[model samples]
Target: MTKKSTIKVEEVNNQIVDWLKSYAGHSKVNGFVIGISGGIDSAVTSTLCAQTGLQVLCVEMPIHQATSHVTRGREHIEQLKKRFPNVSSVEANLTSVFDTFITTVPNNVDAGKVNLALANTRARLRMTTLYYFASVHGLLVAGTGNKVEDFGVGFYTKYGDGGVDLSPIADLLKSEVFLLGHFLAVPQSILKAAPTDGLFGDDRTDEDQLGASYDELEWAMSQAEIHKSSLDFTGREKVVFEIYTRLNAVNQHKMLPIPVCRIKK
Candidate 1:
């Protein structure tokens, strides 16, 4: 895997800010809306939105998250509001909402699958909240998923975090995102903190679910080229390919395009 980066983080930040400005202007939307999860991706994406000098609605939609996670999310949004006049934020604690969904849904699944489904439901709930505010305010829902999560590993939930009008950092790798975060002066705590989806309710992290670190995932992603090449892969390359294939299988559904059936005349 290549350790050196050709992309300039500062330039990327400026370009994304500019893109957001132009997109919102052309689309005639008043501003951008983002769900702040206290992870670096949300922190950087929201900061980039703030940098655009346009109205940015940062919502903290916590669903039975850890106290620390909720606090971090709230504090980050507050910081954005204090620093950027165009930034505004609100909290949508969906504990009751989620509980209602769980209790109301059909109780026909096993315990582990039920937990996974509920976690994903949290993401969909946040997506619903974001679009609700966007519709009310004439804004676009801004997504926080980075390249590794969005494209490489497809770690995001479909129509959940994946449902957004724009993904400002979707092209940025996890490592590159941290670079942009550091450049944008995002809080050091957020930068260094362990990344989590906050979807699993209490304290489960992304890595815990994926069974690999971002660095390893990134490295594993780089092996796709080698996996497809006609040239032979050595022992290490094969091992990495195995990990990549296993992790990537989890995203097969995410990678599938919307199913369409042909209507025969």
Candidate 2:
């Protein structure tokens, strides 16, 4: 069962918009820059940034991306532009760049590790692109990570999708992001599409990589918070809890601050 936050959408929406406006105002930046991935998280995040009525740059960094993802991303960008005058978009096709990088790197390892490394490379390249735009425009790179992925399972790249100037929706879960997305009137194509990182250039979903759905992971997260043990669960629930715990442990490096070696002197 998917557990959704009981947060009041309208109230939370207003709070986030106000918060974004305040943060940008204090930081003396123009606005936000977000990578549109045709997924609910980005759609909702960009919309929230738009609600601030500040400059919001929706960037498309596609590197051998799936057709559906590109289409949905373009659709959402168009819809957002129509609704907000402060919204603008740019597409940075990185296919050739990715191909060049692949050739430059040594791939003596097996195909599996090579593919995984390249996928992460795609994310890092996009991160660099976003920061490039942000630097040029004097805007903040807004992150699209939600609570489940950012906190519970740590399902984001280290400095890739994980890199950002600010996280506007990091407190919300995947389900809560959908709720906010629905309230924000994000494009239906994005709302209905399967969640993907678009890093692998294939149709494989976040679930395919994570071994559990967002809903199941959300449930497991809640159970863990209550100090529940694997013995408390049975069947698929038990399996999911184990999966969530394993990932949460291994990916703590991603979630926590970078460890600095301290001097005992």
Candidate 3:
């Protein structure tokens, strides 16, 4: 059974928008740049940023092999443009860059680690593009991670997709994100599509990697929140214990600052 989210979608959206704008102001950012994955999270984030009167540059960085979500990205961008005339879309193909880097690396590395390295590389590539555009246009990088993904599972690459100047929906859960999308009138198709990171040749979904459905994970996260145990080892007890424990242990890299030693002056 899935635990219901307690947040009011409209209230969360308004609060996030106001908070994001204030963050932008404090950082002296004139606009925002974001990468849209054709997933609901990015769509909702883009919509909120646009509605806030920020000049939004939405980039679609699709590898040549994974073109399935390209059309969806286009439609999302179009909807954004209707509300934010200043919104712009760009296509950045990452195949050549990924290929060149992989070819140069020695094959002695573990294949699984190599694959993760490549995925992280692609994420960094997208971030690099956003940063360059932001620097040129005087905009901030708008992040699209939700609380379920970032806080619960820590499902983000460090300094990769994890890099952001401000996150608009960092506090909202996955279920709440859908509610916010519905309240904002986001396209129904995008809101309903299975969430994916678009990182693999097979076009993998987030649930496949996470070992559970978003509904399940969200429930576990909510329980963890109430229990104040970042790991929710209740209900399904064992399975939840394994998933929560492993994720927290392995993904701790996502939670900490790079270690720096204090030198005596």
Give the distance in Å from residue 126's predicted Cα in candidate 1 to where it truly belongs. Answer: 0.8
Q: List the residue pairs that clash in candidate 1.
A: none
Candidate 1, backbone clash total: 0
* Ranking 1 against 2 by TM-score, winner: 2
The TM-score ranking, best first, is: 2, 1, 3
Q: After superposing candidate 2 on the true structure, give the runs of residues whose Cα lies further than 4 Å from its correct spot.
A: none
How many angstroms is residue 3 displaced in model 3 relative to the true structure, after the best TM-score fit? 1.7
lDDT of each: 0.83, 0.93, 0.81
Candidate 2, residue 178: CA error in Å?
Answer: 0.5
lDDT of 3 by residue, 1-265 (tens): 5868778777777887888788877888787998988889999999888877878899888765455588778889998888778788887877787788778878687889877777778889888988988898999999999987787788887887899988888888888889899998888879878998877666678988888777877766656645645343544654664675578668877877778999999
> What's the C-alpha lDDT at position 42 in model 1?
92
In model 2, what lDDT does residue 44 have? 94
Tens-place lDDT per residue, model 1, 39-148, is 89999999999988888999988777788877777778888888999999888888899989978899787988988888889989989999999999999999998878
| Number of colliding residue pairs in each model | 0, 0, 0
